[model samples]
Target: MNTDPKVLIVTSAFGDGHMKVAEAIENSFRRRGISRITTLDLFAVVHPALNELSRRFYLNNTGYTQEFYGLLYTMTSKMRPEQFMGRLIHSMGKRKVQRIINEIQPDIIIHTFPYLAAAELASTTGSRMPLFTVMTDYVVHGRWLHPQTTKYFIASEDMKTTLMSAGVAEEKLVVSGIPIREAFEQTQDREALLRKHGLSGDRQYLLLAAGAYGVLSDISSLIKRVLLQSSFDVIVLCGNNHKLRAATGELFQENPRVHILGYTEEMQELMCIASCLLTKAGGITLTEAMAQALPVIVYRPLPGQEAGNAEWLSGQHLIEIARNEEQLVEQLQRLEHTAYRDEREQHMKVFSRKSASDAIVTEALEAIKLRQPSVPAAKSMLVEGQAKTIHGYY
Candidate 1:
């Protein structure tokens, strides 16, 4: 491995989960003494206006008409880069990627989000670099698949199997788990974290993870329902959504059991103290919660990739999925049983043992050591005095 490595982590703002995964991978690379890391939002860089419009459309479509989003997901599940929509999307950022490759000359390019267009720089244009794609969700959406991808860092064996079934070479896939923040790697003290958060062990905590957008629907009603079910306290994480936080705070301020908070960096601490989690099925949060052995309950997951993530994990008994308040509460009630909680915890711990970020870094670097001018990106960027390639994706 080079003493000083340049890494470009291409991510999107489609959801904060993808960006969070990129951050985690960046942190991991930094730990390896590799600096010169740049995290990019490729679409916004290529065409800011269109990116914003599409972003708004995504938010509106997913937040309101989720059934349509699911239908789209199903329709595009088998799309190839040569197909109409896929070709259009995959063609967006080639020039920007080539310019970026010439400018930064990164050693390796990792995609925490799925943007297949990056591969066109090398795959179609005869450039070369190591382009690794990391799937942040449980679903293997066709958007992420491409023949040019050097490696596929997937979430589970299930995804590897799916990709294999799709004719992807088995050797090209790595079940290294999803990359999480460096914070999850440290030893978190339960008692100390409890004191720091003004929480207690006496009361079981129900964590409502609204993620970065505060996307939890009818969250107040859900909180009220959970309160009615038990004496357990509630902690709401309204990420970046100040209005939702303020409204939730105003509504629940008088209730001693309910604590509504905006974005706080003490997420690991909160998850440490939490007895159960009620949230959407975004892969990054689910991976973080599972890594802490926290029982995850997906409540009315938005109908596309979220539904896919919830279904697969739930089927394996690793997590519970609820379509309504009643089922969500029922899942929480079941967690109250010591035996049931322990069983779920056991399933979660099995997954927690895999050090995803570290494994990814080690394997990527080892590949570099083994094959000097690895992949397309390395072809332009330098490796041992030769020009290197750029793993160009955003």
Candidate 2:
């Protein structure tokens, strides 16, 4: 019998960060020769239609009604996760999570997103499946916390402090940084990458990433102003946003200075060649940029987690928060100064925890070899928890 520890990585596709983090963890495990791995999208598996509907609503909410969305997020952040509403939200994927746990009997259950059903299932049933949570943001909310979580791989010391204040044991919080793909961990030839993209390594190039969903409404105007007001060339990466790519390409077809691209697998290569990154404050993208030590400029992050991430990282001096096009241009101009660029790069040096996935995998493998997890086949039952007041915020 070929025996290997069965691993289950549960993630959600509400944001690209969750799935990306799952991929990083899966790839890291593969690299470490752990082949018995299964990756699951909890929401998609449990409620496909609802998952799709909610994802669209989420995109719309964050893109259009960010204030309302922030209010919701803030309210939920203060929630006692085991309470009624919180438990109701947490119960969404319980049945499916239980089935998977029963089927695989995984030695580990890792979460990239805050799908706490597995943690809940284990807690109520007295099972210890070694649930691991990899928080992809600079900030930690109550959603990512569970008393049953085995370990928390967080993005910074600030998050550690937040968790400590929340009563999470210091030993359980690992400041591993947000886990990124293997591509970032490996070195690439920057000059060759520049040539492949039909660019000379001679001039400064500004990379404008329109986020994973291509939701930046002001991207076109923003680029026009950047091209007009600045001395640097522009390259727009409209990730998975076919509409944005097509529209941007048509608009900038006549302008050789602006290079518009669609979804690309070589984001690391692009980051390697770009002088600086102008993008959303999504946790994964910021983590990816940090891995490359790429100076980042986030233009008015949407409220909620984006705002929280921007606020936390800004204090650390890891990224510049530009409130408007004028401020963005000012930030870009600052990048032209060799001294300022070097300063930003040095800040990243202190923040970037290289190969966070590898770090988690190393610890996990050791733990697995050290002691077999005391877990049994998961069983479905009524989840009981008390209602606790969740602080509401604006």
Candidate 3:
């Protein structure tokens, strides 16, 4: 008999943060010798067509329609979990999710997306499978709260306080930072990594990433300003955005100092090599950068979650924000100063939780052990209960 716990990680690809968090958790479980693991994309599994369309719509809106996206975010930001919009969003995927639960019969279900699957699983009669939700952002949204959630692995203490103020049980919240891959926690030899990537160890490197979608507007202008104003070599990661890659290649073809890459798996190494990072404020990316102790410069984050993340990190003095070309250039110059860089690194060391993924896995395993019944005993109880029911009926 296999005693290994079966874990079902439900995530959605609305943005890369959700999938990244799921991957981190999966990797943590694998490292801990938990073999029976399955990962499901909730939207893709429940409603394929809707998932694709909604994903496209989200990217388009976040990339091009800033005002409209901000409007939608503002309109729903303060809604209660039981509100009409929340219920409607959750109900859309509930039936399909329940079907998945019935088929998998997992020991525990972990969610990285804000979906209604938790509520459905909780409402299932006689179901005791632990349901855990990992909030990828620093702020808590109403959509992420469900009374039925067995536990919440949140990003920070302030987030926990917010959830508590909104009536979440104290025991249900755990400040595990954000679940990032274990690689981020390991000490990276900067010189070795630079050599491995065929990059110059002598040159001061600046990394600019626009999330995984390359959605930041006027990236070309930003790159140009950085190159013209700073002495550092610029490395732009155009993740899965071929158009952005092609455009950047054409624009910086003559500049040997500018390196443009597309969809790299060496983000950790690149971040380690960077003197500073100028990127949008995606939660996972920020966490990864923080892990490396790299000074961060955030520019023109999108209106909702990105804005909130930027605000929180800046408030903590862990990052610098540049809203325009001049401020960006100035921030880059500031990063060149040894004292400023050291200050930011010290702040990051204080802010970052290096063992977040491991901590989350430990908590999850303990929670599962407390809730799980011995299989043989569970089967015997079921048989005895059925027999008594039949006898009573006769």
Candidate 4:
């Protein structure tokens, strides 16, 4: 364990998806023999009150408050680069984060959540350490493209072009796919994975992932609607919402084909047994599903980042958006056809099945090495010595 190369990962629990990606990257680093890793939930430590507010807003009153978040995103989208709320949050969070950074004194700081990208930029100002951001969403957000970022890790080619258009030097971006849990990359036979979980490939599996905060979002209604029209087994994973899970579990108890679980680490296994997913277009879940070649039906994606992810998925043909129960049912019926299944598999082929976590850790190490004075100039070459490796076309 070379304690000299300590890396600090800054994240938040605004959503479980972001933290999951950070955890994946951290695990990847450890797997590659880079053991000096520190992961922090910035909001948890820096401002517990604000974190609680976010939790209540998203988890407790999601239906009523979702529009407010949408309005905020719309406002931020139209506002000038210098006047964004993201900038304000950074200004407010900078001092506390900077103090933490000074104490940790890490060689590199990687951020998976853009909630504090601006704050992180401010924290590392004038410091010798390098700060990089791995964009958690498939779509690009101005908040994630920090002007001072040492490097930008992205999920897709389109994001790179958006960043370049925003004046980010093309050379500094790395396409590392959305960082997913290493479990998604574990080798296992499809039959074995299904049998281990008492699932049958003979019946199509529909996996529903309620968001981390546990806002039901009418997803259970959508699932029930779909179940009424089909014989496929429905497996719903309501992450962290025991009440919602119990309520839904009872609702489906008489129906032998429906299963409900409250927060389990068996998501990858479930994905292997499932053919279709119904969930929010969270970056982490979306990427994991793609890694497993599971086509998805997205429901009520959050306004900014998640909406972007849904749009990307739609463009990729990896998913279809269904904001209402009717639409969700309609899409599921349409996707049940063998033709749609073939198309979905073709779309899944576009995604990289290999572990992005490993790729991210490799790039992180290279980024650190590039920052070292001892590394030769030739070793500093970026992406095969091209001034910019553009893949948005790919």
Candidate 5:
């Protein structure tokens, strides 16, 4: 630990979940009084054009563009290295990173996105700096693995096992659940939470979540069907999708039981008040709902990653998957008759007691403290002077 300790967090904007996880780690350090923290959107800062194109692809064509990503994934997985892709990315970013690292002289570095793995690999070429890769997703992709790296923080035991099967050393892996917003981990008064949202505590409150794009076309129609068939109150969160929000808003507005919100910061509170959740099976949202002990009813999930996530949730009994609106509603209606509530709670206990931020920060701090400069003089000064400074500040 160095006084005025420098910590760098590298992430990408490929998905909101990755950035959210990175920010949660940064927030944890900030809470511990580590103010000298820098967060880099490696894609934006290094390859702006590529980042924009990727963002546009996800927004405009992600639903149909899996083939393109699949090809890239295949290329990387083959050990081809695509030296050209690596060279191009590094050529654009190397000098800038060298300058930034030289100036900051960071004590520890944490990377949250896989593309940045190349950047970390390049940056630590000859340095002894500890680089911890945080796998924001549940599954381990070839993109995130690098042998020279110091360690990895993964989201689940399944992920850890996946890495082990891939031949990654067991000692280098730490099963830290995905770091989520601190607010999600804290307990909130459900009655007060419902009141704040202009919701009724007595009614069955359902939190409906879809990604920012609202990729699932059946979402609005499904919610409508539920409204007509069930007595529960539904709150729909159509993130950034104005068109979907407006359409859903029109349908739910006139009705007293249905509430449609575009986006808001009261997600934790909403989860607290929600008796159940109806949404796509994104890892963070699924885990957050589980953290709140809310049973989940997953609407139709898109193919690929989301489908995999839905499968994982179903296998854990943390959520019920529906092939269509009819089956989804049937599952929800059954919630009243079974111990489904306690079942979800019991299954979620494995992830509920774990703190993503705590595990990350603890490992990061240890790595920073254990680091010794190549020179004896700098090592002694870092141990005595920097350690005192870091303790005082953090």
Candidate 6:
């Protein structure tokens, strides 16, 4: 009698943030004793070739054709609810997604990606299973809203207002602060982490993470400039970009202050040991850096979501933006001041909420209980009201 609530976490691989959020939620479920869990990438399952091609195209475009990509993002962001793209995506993915739902019969389906699959799942008849969406970005886009989303776990109360203004009911939105892996929330002894990684703990560390795809621009130039300063050591995470690793290794081989690492599972440990993080403004990385309470220096954020994230974080004073090599050097130098570092750290403490995963898991469990047939009719009525209210928006 395996009676633990079944959960299906539907995510997409278009970006690493969605997958990371999925992993975080999955980890939270396991911690809460939910054994029956399934994680799936809708595109990978429904349209494998398109998934691969689109993912490749996205990576390449974000790395190179950023202007065109931003244009596309802006156009799509303004799409109306009746737009054809949503319907087209729903049609393409619905059958496969519905089949998965039929097989698993999960108590709930959690979506960490954009809401196309959720729109498909919602369109299915007799689809009583609750669907919850976790918005990885600080800003909300039109694509993230759907009538079928029973709840939205967004990054902040301001986002909740954004959704509500767009017609989402107050009860259906939770300000969860972007769920991140539990490992990030754990305290790491800075000295132990540095010793284990064979780095000097006495010196301040500037952690340069270019994301898992090595999407940042002019990383070598940034590294070269940072190395000229004797106040801090530079640690660069090149992720899975072999070309980048090779190029950087050759460039910095003689420099003892520089360390280049490939894709690593030790991000939490690394973030913990670093005095500050210098990276592009991917939502998950921003949240992760904030979780570690490490001051951030954002450099060359990509055109769309990354730019939005940078704007929000910088506005909050949780991060400093460096638009060029000169600005990057200046921001790095600014980190050396005790007042500046402490001020940013305090901002991080106020802005970052590490309990998002746990909070989401708890709310989901409650939603499941309310949806149970044994629950009171009044609770069911409330859910129905929410669904109807959301439908009115569409």
lDDT of 6 by residue, 89-121 (tens): 556767555665666667888888774665665
Q: Tell me the lDDT of candidate 4.
A: 0.70
Kindly list the per-residue Cα lDDT of model 2 for residues 159-226, writing each as its tens digit. 89989998999989898988888787677899899889899777788888764333445778888888
Cα RMSD (angstroms) for every candidate in the order listed = 5.2, 6.3, 8.8, 8.2, 6.5, 7.6
lDDT of 1 by residue, 243-306 (tens): 7888888888999899888767778888889999887788888888898889999887777798
Which candidate comes out best when scored by lDDT? Answer: 2
Candidate 3, 118-188: lDDT as tens digits: 57556655467678889898877788877778889988999989999999999999998998887888898
Identify the leading candidate in terms of TM-score. 2
Model 3 per-residue lDDT at 282: 78
- Clash totals for all models, in order? 17, 0, 0, 0, 0, 0
TM-score of each: 0.89, 0.90, 0.90, 0.85, 0.85, 0.89
Estimate the lDDT of model 6.
0.77
Can you list the residue pairs that collide in candidate 3? none
Lowest-sum lDDT 10-residue window in model 5: 385-394
Question: Which is superior by TM-score, 3 or 5?
Answer: 3
Clashing pairs in 6: none
lDDT of 4 by residue, 158-181 (tens): 878877887889888988788877
Cα-lDDT of candidate 5: 0.69
> Which one wins by TM-score: 3 or 4?
3
Better of 1 and 5 by lDDT: 1
Clash count, predicted structure 1: 17
Residue 273 in candidate 4 has what lDDT? 83
How accurate locally is residue 327 in candidate 2, as Cα lDDT from 0 to 100? 97
